[model samples]
Target chain A: MLYREAGQFKTSYAADQAIFPLAQDRIGMAIILAVAFIAIPAVANEYWLQTIMIPFLILSLAALGLNVLTGYAGQLSLGTGGFMAVGAFAAYKFATAFPEMNIIVVFLISGLISAAVGIVFGVPSLRIKGFYLAVATLAAQFFLLWLLVKYPWFYNYDPSGVISAPPIDIFGFAIDTAVSKYMLTLIIVSVLALATKNLVRSHIGRGWMAIRDMDIAAEIIGFRPLTTKLSAFAVSSFLVGVAGAMYAFLYLGSVEAAAFDITTSFNILFMVIVGGLGSVLGSFIGAAFILTLPIFLDNFPRMLGFEISVETVTHLQFMIFGALIIFFLIVEPHGLARLWTITKEKLRAWPFPY
Target chain B: MAFFLEVLTGGLLTGVLYSLVALGFVLIFKASGVFNFAQGAMVLFAALFFVGFIDLGVPVVLSAILTIAVMILLAYLIERLVLSHLVNQEAISLFMATIGISYFLDGFGQTIWGSDIRRLDIGLPQDAFVFGASVLGDDIFVNELDVVAAVVAGALVAVLAVFFSKTKIGRALRAVADDHQAAMSVGIPLRSIWMIVWAVAGIVGLVAGIMWGAKLGVQFSLSLVALKALPVLILGGFTSVPGAIVGGLMIGAGEKLAEVYLGPVIGGAIEDWFAYMLAMIFLLFRPQGLFGEKIIERI
Candidate 1:
C-alpha cells in the first residue's frame, strides 16, 4: 500500500516528463540519497569508507561512462583502462602545473583531455563494427599505457614513473580524510549519474540508442552516425576519465601506468555487463556486486569457521568469478538491473492481477 | 646486411608460431562467428596439462595423445554447456562468454598444475645453424627449433588445406560456416559441426602450446601469445586461413624490424605495441582486413 502510485496524476507535460514522475520513486530516491549522504558517512568505519564505498563510487562512475557507449550506443570498447589512464595522468599534470587551482576544475579538465583522446580512438568505430571494432580499441589500450609509461613528461619526470595525487583542497577544505574523500566522490558521482540519466533521455541519447539498435535505420531517419558515435565516445571517456582521476587522487593516492592494464579494462567491462548494459542503475549495481564479491569471498570463509590460504582463496575467487559471469549471462543476459526492474514491476502490481 | 637477414629470418619463424595460434581463432570464428577470446587460455591449459603429464612420468607420445583427448573433451563440454544455450545470441555475448571461459581455464589450469613455470623438453635441438658465413664474410644465426617449427607449420597447413578440400567432415564444417540455418535445413548437425571445429581448434592450440612452451617455457605468460596473435587475426581476416599465415608473418617481421630499426627513436620497446598499432592503422583504411570478405550491412 505504501509503495502504490494509485493516485498519482500528471497535471502538465512537465510533470509527465519528469525524471521520476511517481511519488513513490521520488521518495525512494530521496531516502537513498539521504542514506548515502548522511547515514553511511556518519556510521561507516574508515576501511569501509576508503576501500569499499569509495572504489565502488569511482568505478560505478567509470562503468556508467562505459555503459553510455557500450550499452546505450552499442559500441564495444576494451580500451577503458587506457582512457582512464589518460584521465589520471592528465589530472596529475594539470594539478602539478597549476597547484593553486581547485581539484574539481582539475578533474573536469582531465575529463576533457580524455574526451579528445577517446574521439581519436573512436574514429575506427564508423568503419568497423562489433568484434573488429573491439580489437581496434585494444590499440588504444596498449598504446596509451605505453605512452604514459614511456614518456616521463606525463608523470613530470618522476624517477619511478609513478604519480601521487597531490592533496585535493576545495574551498579551503582539504580532502585528506576517508570521510572527506568519500563525500567528494559521492557528490561528483551523484551529479554525474543524475546528469547521465537526463542526457540519455535527451535527443543525443536517443541518437545513440538508435545507432545501437540499428545504425542504418537510424541514419535513414536523419541521425548522423559519425556524430552520434563520436559524441558517445567523447562523453563516455569523459566520465571514465573523471573516475580514473578520482581513482588516483581519492582512492589509490599513488599509481603507476601499469595499474591501468588490459585486466583493468576487462574488469570495468565486466562491471558494465554484469550490472546491466543499457541501464544507468546497472552501472552502480554491477560495480557494487563486483567490488563486494572479493570482500564477500574473503570474509565468508572466515565467517564459516574455516581458515583459507590466500593462494587458495585467489584461485577460488577466479573460478567463482568466471562461473558467475557465465551463469549471470546465461540466466539474465540483460544483467542485474533487469532483475531489479522486474522485481519493482511485480511489487507495483502486488495484491492485484493485471 | 647479415644482421638484417638474421632478424628477418627470426621474425618469419616467430610469425609461424603466431599463425598457429591465430589458426585456432580463425577456425572458431569461421564456424560459429564467435571471437573465441579463450584461445589463449586454451593454449596455456594445454601446455600446462602436457607439462603436468610429463612431470607425472608419462611418455611424450602418450602425453601428447592424452592432451589431445582432454582437448576434445573440453570441446564437447564447451559446446554442451556454453555454446548450446548461446546459439542465436549476439557476437558480443559469445565474445564475453569466451572471456568467462578464459578465466575459468586460467584458474583451473593453475590450480591443477601449480602456477610455477616448468621447463618443457620435447628433445628438439636448440643449436643455432650458422649461415652466409662464406658469402657475406659474417655469420647469420638461425635457431634449429625455429626451422623445425616452420617445417611443422608448413606440413600442418598443407594437411589442413587438403582435409578442407577433400574430406566429408571438412565439407560439413565449411557448409556450417557458410550459413547455419541453410546447413541445418539441408540435414547437417550444427552441434556436431561446432564440436568438430572446436576439436580442430583445440589441436591447433595444442601444437601452438607445445612450440611456444618449448621456446619460452610452459608458464602463465604463454597465454599472452594469444593476445599478441590478435593483431595477426585482424591483419589476416577472421575467416581466412591464408590470412592468418600472411598476417602472422607480416606482424612478426614488422614488429622485429621496427624494434631493431625504429626502436632507437622511441627508446627501444616498440615490439610490445607495434603490431597493434599497425593493425589499428590498417583497420582505418580497410576495415575488412587484408583478406576478410567485405562487410555488407543490412537494415
Candidate 2:
C-alpha cells in the first residue's frame, strides 16, 4: 500500500522524465543518504569503518567501472586488476612526484592515465568479440603486471616492492582517520555512482546497451562500433581507475603488486555478476555481499562454540562461496538487479492474481 | 646446441601437460561456447580429488574409477544446476558465472580436502634411464610421459572425432554446436549432450591433473596453469580439438623458450606473459587463429 504509485502523475516533461520518477524512491533514497552520510558516521565504530565499509565502497566503485563496460557495452574484460594497477601506480607516482597536488586531483589524473592505457588495449575489441576479447585483455594483464613488478621507477625503487600512502590531506583537514577516509570515499563513490547511473540513462549509455544487446542491430541503427566501443572502454577504465586510486589510498594504505592480481580481477567481476550486471546499486550490494561473507563465515564457528580455525573457516567459506555462486546463477542469473525488478513488480501487482 | 635440445624437450613436455588442461577448455568451448575458466580450477579439483581418494586408502584403479564417477556426477550437476539456466545468455554473464564457479570450486576443493598441498603420486613409473647426458627416464624423464600424454591426447581426440562422426549422439552434439535451435527442433537432447560434454571435459581434466601432479604435485598452481590454454585457443581456435592440441604444443614450446632465452633480457619472468603476448600478436594479425575458422561478424 505504501508503495502505491497511482496518484503520482506528472504535469511536465521535465518532471515526467526526471530520475526517481516515483515519489517513494526519492524519499527512500533520501533516508539512505541520511544514514550513510549523517547517521552512520555518528554511530559506527572505527573498525567497521576501516575494514568493511571502506573496502566495500572502493570495490563497488571498481565494479561500477566494470559494469559500465562489461554490463552496458557488452564487452568482456579479464584485466581489471591490470588497469587498477595502472591507476594505483600512476596515483602513487603523482602523489610522490608532485606532493603538493591535491590527492583528489591525483585520483582523477590516475584515472585519465588508465583510460589512455585502456583505450590502447581496448582497440582490439573493435575486431574481437566474446571469449576472444577476454583473451586479448589478458595481454594487458600480464604486460602491465610485469611492468609494475619489473620497473623499479614505478615503486620509487623501493627494495621491498611495496608502496605506502603518504598521509593524504585536503586543504589542512588531515584526513587520515578511518572515519574521514570512509566519508571521503562515500562522497566520491556516491557522486561517481550517481553520474554513472545518469550516464547509463543518457545517449552514450543507450548506445552501449544497444551494442550490448545486439551489435549488428546497433550498427544498423547508426551506432559507430569503433567510437562507441572504445569510449565504453575508456569511460569504464576511468571509473575503475579512480576506484583503484581510492583502493590504494584508503583501503590497503600500503601494498604490493600482488594486491591487484588476476584473483582480484575475478573477485570484482564476480561482485558485478552477482550484484547485478548493469545496475549501480547492485554493485554496492554485490561488493558488500561478497566481501562481508568471509567475515561472517569466519565468525560462524565461534558463534557455534566449535572453535574452528580461521584457515578451516576460510576453506569452508570458499566451498560454500562456490556453491552460493552456482546457487545464485541458477536462481537468478540476472544477478540482484532481477531481484529488484521482481520486488517492484510484486509491489505493483499487490492484492491481485491476474 | 645440447641446451637448445634440452629446452625444446622440456618445453614440449610442458606443452603436453598444458595441452591436457586446454583439452578440457577446448572441448567445452567447442560443444558449448562458454569458455570454462573453471577448467584450471577443475584440474586442481581433479588432482586433489584423485589424491584425496587415493590417500584415503582406496585402490589406485578403484580411486580413479570412483573419481571418474564423481566427475560424471559433478558434470551432470553443473549442467542441470548452473548451465541449464544460462543456455542463451550473453557471453559475459556466462563467463562471469564460470568465474564464480571457479571461486566456488577452489573454495570447495580447499574445504573438502583441507588447504594443505597434498602430493598426488598415482604410481606412474618415476625411475629415469639416462643415455649419456641425455636422459630418457622413468614414466617421465620428460620423454616417457611426453609420449604417453601426447598419445593419450591423440587417442582421445581421435575417439571424439569418430564419436562425433559415427555416433548419432555425437552427430547431435555437433548439430547443437552448429546451431542450438535447429538441433533442439530435430529432437536432440541438448541437456544430456551438455552433461556428456562436461563429463568428458572433467575426465580430460582428470588425466591432466594426474600428469601435472606427477610433475608438480597437487597445488593451486594447477588452476593457474589453465592460463596457458587462452593462448592455445588464440592460436588454434576455440572450436577445433586438433587446433587445441597443436596450439598447446606451440605455446608450451614458445613459453619455455621465452623463459630460457628471453627471461633474462626481460628481467627473467616471461612465462607468465609469453603465451598471452603471442595470443595478442596473433589476435592483431590473424584474429582467427591458425586452425580457427575465419570469424565474420554480420555487419
Candidate 3:
C-alpha cells in the first residue's frame, strides 16, 4: 500500500520523535508544500490566488493560533478577532513608522504586541473557566475593536478610518502581485505550521494538554497554571496577530477595525471546531472548508440549473453552516481532522479485517 | 439631577427588558445544564414569526397564538434533534451546539420571513410618561412602553418564581437541574423535563421578542440583544433567576449612567463595552457571580 509504514523503522530517539516519522507522511507533506509553493502558483488565476488562496492561508494560520489555546490549552477564547486586530493595527503602525524595515519583521513585532495584549486579556482565565471565560474574552473583542475605531491614531488619523497596507519593497524588489503575496503568506504559514506542530508536541504542549484535560491535576503535577495558560494565550495571539497582519497587508490590502468583528472571531472559532480542535493539520482543513463553503454553495445552485436569489442563498448558507456544525459535532465530535485520522488508520489496515 | 434621574430610570426600564432575555437563558441552563446561546435567536424568530403572521393579515391574537405554538414546536425540535443527542457531553460542546442552533434559527427565520425590518405593534402605548414637570419646571419623560415592559417582566418573574416553587412539573424541573440521574430515578423523565423547560424558555423568548421588537422594530439586530444579556448573566449568576433580574437592572443602569456621564470625557458610544468590562471586573472578585452556586472543582 502507498500509505504503509511496514518497511520504515526508527533507528534512534530523534527518528522516533520526528513530527512526520513515517516516510509516507513526509512524502505527503512534501507534495502538499510543493503544490502550494509551485504548482498552484503556476496554474492558478489571479482571483484564485488573491481571493481564495491568500485568505485561506492567513485564516489557517489564525485557526492554528486559536487551536493552540482553545484546543490545546483548554481555554476557550472568543478574542481571536481582537488579537488579530491588534496585530493588523500594530503591523500598520510598525510598517508606517519604520518604512525601511523588512515586512516580515514588521509582522513579527505586530504579533509580539498582540501577544502582550492577549496576555492582559488572558489574565481573567486564571479565575474563570468555560462559558464565563468565553464571555470575558468578548470584553477584549469589543474593547479592542472600540479602541481601534475610537482613536484615529490607530489608523494614523485617516478620516476614513481604514488602514491601507503600504507597498512591499523587500530590498528594492516589489512583492505586490497576487502570486507574490500568496507566496509570502504560503511561506509564513508553512514555517509557522511546522513550528506549531513541534511546539504542540514538546513538553510545553504536554503541559497545555495537562491543563486542558484537568487543571487541578495539572497543577498538582507541578505545571504552573499562570505561566502555562498565559504562554498559550501569548503564543496563540502571536500567531493570530501575524495572520491578521497578513490578512490586512496581503489578502485585503486595506482594512478597517470593523473587519475584525465578533463575527470574525466566531468564524475562526468555527474553523478550529469544525477542523479538529487539537490537530495542526485540522486547522488548514477547517479553514479551507469554512472559506470554500460559501463559494461552493453559491456555485452549486448555478451548476444544478437552479436560479436562487443571492439573498436566499446567503440565508441557506447560514442554515447549512449551522446544521453542519451540529451534524459534525454529533457525528464526529472530534471534527474533520479525526475523520482524516480514521481514514488513514483504515487505509493502514485496508483489505484485511482482523 | 432631573436628566440623571431620567437616564437612571430609563436604564432600569431597559434593564428589565434585558432580564426578560436573561430569564430564558436561566431557565434552559438551570433545567438542562445547556447554555442556550440560541435564546436570542429564539427571541428574534418568535418576533419575526409574530410580525410575519400579522403582516399576512392574521389578527394580532391569532398571530400571538400561532407564534407561541411555533415556539413550542421549536423547543420540541431542538430538544429531540439537538439536546437529546448532546446529553452528557461536555458543557462547552453543548454551548457550541446552541450557537449552531442560533445560526440555524437566524437563517431559517430570515429565510422564511424575509430579512427586512418589520414593525411590531400590539397596541402598546408609545407615548412618553411625564413626571416632575412642575417640581423642576421641566418634564422628565419615561417611555410608556418601557413601563409596560417593566411591569410585564416583573409579573413574568413572579409567575415563574411561583411556578418553580408550587407546581409538580416545576419541582421535577428543579430535581432534573440538581441531578439528571437522580431525577430520572425519581420517575421524572429527563427528556420531557428538557422539552418542557425549553418550551417555557421559548415562551419567555416570545415575551422578550415582543417587547424588544416593539421597541427596536423586528430586525436581525434584535438577536444581538442576547449579547447584552450575557453581561447580566455574568453579574447575576448563570443559574439564578432572581440574579438575572438584579444583574440586568445593574448593567442597564450602570451602562447608561456611564455612557451619559462619561461620554463627553471620552468620545461617545461607551455603551457597547461598558457592561462587559463591569462584568469582567465583577467576575474577578466573584467568579461564581453574585447569586450563582459556588463552583467546587474536584481533581
Runs in model 3 with CA error above 4 Å?
B132-139
lDDT of candidate 3 at residue B193, scale 0 to 100: 89
lDDT of 1 by residue, B1-299 (tens): 88898999899899999999999999999988989999999999999999899999999999999999999999999999988988787777788888998888888888888888899997987889986664477789998998888888888889888888899988888898899899999999999999988988988899999999999999989888899999999999999999999999999999999999999988878788899989988988988889998889877
Q: What's the C-alpha lDDT at position A22 in model 1?
A: 87
Off by over 4 Å in 1: A1-5, B132-135
Task: List candidate 2 stretches off by more than 4 Å.
Answer: A349-354, B123-144
Looking at model 1, residue A31 earns an lDDT score of 100
Model 1, C-alpha of B188: deviation from truth (Å): 1.3
- Largest lDDT belongs to which candidate? 3
- Report the interface RMSD that candidate 2 achieves against the true structure, in angstroms: 2.0
- For A1-354, candidate 3 gives per-residue lDDT tens digits of 678788898899999999888988899989988998899999999999988999999999999999999999989988899999999999999999999999999999999999999999999999999888988999999999998999888988889666678998777779999898888889899999999999999999999999999999999999999999999999999999999999999988886888899999999998998898899989999999999988898899899999988899989988998998899888877879999999999888886835
What is the RMSD, in Å, between candidate 1 and the native fold over all Cα? 1.4
Give the count of colliding residue pairs in each prediction. 0, 7, 0
Q: What is the TM-score of chain A alone in each candidate?
A: 0.98, 0.98, 0.98
Score candidate 3 by TM-score against the native: 0.98
TM-score of each: 0.98, 0.94, 0.98
Residue A85 lDDT, candidate 3, scale 0-100: 95
